[model samples]
Target: MRPEIIRLLNENQEFRLFVRQNPQWYRKLSRDPSALQSLEKEANYFYGRTFPQRVERMQSNLGLAMMMMEMLKMGQDTVAQTQETFSS
Candidate 1:
């Protein structure tokens, strides 16, 4: 993944969700369970320490930023279109 994408996910809704969803393949107790157990323990600690509400806050901020970014892009596109029409 792109670094910026990873950064957004890390700062926003991704790491927690990735940790939450990482262990789906470990559905059964087995002889080689140490890795899975370690991951679970780490995830548990991470989740325990994280304020889940921050995820919601980050999402809201991201949404607002995206809206503004989109508006700016549209504004630029509109300017380009107006310039083209005037040139023609």
Candidate 2:
């Protein structure tokens, strides 16, 4: 669940969008008794029946994911550029 959620709330929005499009994702979450109960608790305490709260968290995670992605991309690009220069 954690990984999937992270993937969803990522720079690559396809996983998130896929989960949204597929009801199975929600259903699976619902069927997970432990996780569902825990989520309900989180929902009640944090979200308090407000969808915006959950979305806010999701967006925050997405922002983090994007940052990580940018950092990784920058590193890779740097390495590639360095290799090109050194190899030349």
**Top candidate when judged by lDDT against the true structure:** 2
* lDDT, candidates in the order shown: 0.60, 0.63
lDDT of 1 by residue, 9-77 (tens): 367563437544764423322334434455445555566544665676688999999999999999999
Task: Give candidate 1 regions above 4 Å deviation.
Answer: 1-50
TM match of model 1 to true structure: 0.42
Task: List model 2 lDDT by residue over 1-88, tens digit each.
Answer: 4565454336445434554665565656645634544444443554235677778889999999999999999999999999999999
Instruction: After the best TM-score superposition of candidate 1, give how far the Cα of residue 64 lies from its true spot, in angstroms.
Output: 0.6
In every candidate, how many clashes are there? 0, 0
The residue pairs that clash in candidate 2, if any, are none
